[model samples]
Target: MSQPVIALFTDFGVSDPYVGQMHARLVAEAPQARIVDLHHYAPAFSPGPAGLLLEALVPHLTPGSVVVGVVDPGVGTARGSLALATDEHWFVGPDNGLFASVLEAREGRCFRLREPEGDGLSVSFHGRDLFGPAAAALARGDRMVLGEEVAEPVRAEARRDAVLYVDHYGNLMTGLVPPEDGGARLRVEGRNIPFARTFGEVGPGELFWYRNSLDRVEIAAREGSAAKRLGAGTGTAVAWIGGV
Candidate 1:
């Protein structure tokens, strides 16, 4: 049998120890599972945009892999935990609209993560204490940790006409899919960005939008940062220029 895969996606920046603790917990509970770091910088404290970005990533992952998502800002609150079982992957995370895009992508079974009877888990770090362990258990084919089935998770708050993420290179990834025509343009931050097949298609230091690897519209500036150029970031409103 193929090895079990547990991919990690979070807004926990690398400068902190939060992600490391999750890795430690996963390794301890699911040693047989291989861990993949999908991403660690996903628009801090913004799960709606992160969920949209994650939805774009679902098709690229290996079948039946487990994804541990920790973009939760309401970690210690009354907000609940969720386990989303899709045909292509399993997602474990908070119920704060993190899995909304994924849930809307297809039919899936949702389960509430059961709480531990003891008070050992940390309130502020559910990523390591709750989600990590749940992912490990799911990786090991154990669903006992999941509680009741959830009929409807929160709806995705990330709109397709908005910027979902801004990468380190300043590329702006939007939830909107690009059209086949290279002539199609996108408007954001009161600026119009033309389409290009790639960075080389445009002159150096030029700004353009293209269908990114993840099949989403990405705005980039060759030899420069698009975010800086357009003064845009997550939640920036994006609009179609030519009805595409």
Candidate 2:
């Protein structure tokens, strides 16, 4: 058998040494470890974005990979820091009902961490003191304690944004549906909008629904800002009640 893969995900941006420090601790604890950086820019305190990112990445990781996800906005505040061993992978993080729930939602098996008797603990920075070291040990063939098979973990629904991330050209990314059943229809805020593929497909200034490269439903102005004209943002609710 081969050594386990250790994957790291966090809100710690690459500019700082926080991510490096964690990696170093892992190396020190388990000299021959494989550490991978899944992502660091998780939209600061927005667990929704983190959950979305993890969901997209989890199914594809190598079996037996130990994934450390540290997006705990409620770290150190009565939330339990945890080490999770699943059938497919392992996850370590603050148990603020953030990460494991989303991970376990799509997984078939999971277990929580119980404190190892006499193991020195860190209260301030569990990611460094706890998660990093534990993952390292697990990677080194050390036996680990698995937690529980939770039935209802927390969940976050990734909704279609009213306006997606603003692009360089100032084109507002809208959360409109594309051709469904090979056709299109658009409605928003209780009004029926128009539909088109490109700006020239519809009269200038008409808003329409379509899928972008990411295949996400987008709302866009034929040649303008659907957001500024309609007033919306990341979480604005959208509905695509028609197709073909």
Global lDDT scores for all candidate models:
0.89, 0.64
Number of the top TM-score candidate: 1
Native-vs-model 2 lDDT? 0.64
**lDDT tens string, model 1, 96-187?**
89999888879899999987669868989998889889999989988899999998787656788988888889999999977776578889
User: How far in Å is the alpha carbon of 149 misplaced in model 2?
Assistant: 5.8
For model 1, state the Cα shift of residue 77 in Å.
1.0
For candidate 2, report its TM-score: 0.66
TM-score of each model, in listed order: 0.96, 0.66
RMSD of each: 1.3, 5.0
lDDT of 2 at 31: 79
Q: After superposing candidate 2, which stretches have Cα over 4 Å from the reference?
A: 84-87, 100-105, 116-124, 145-233, 241-244
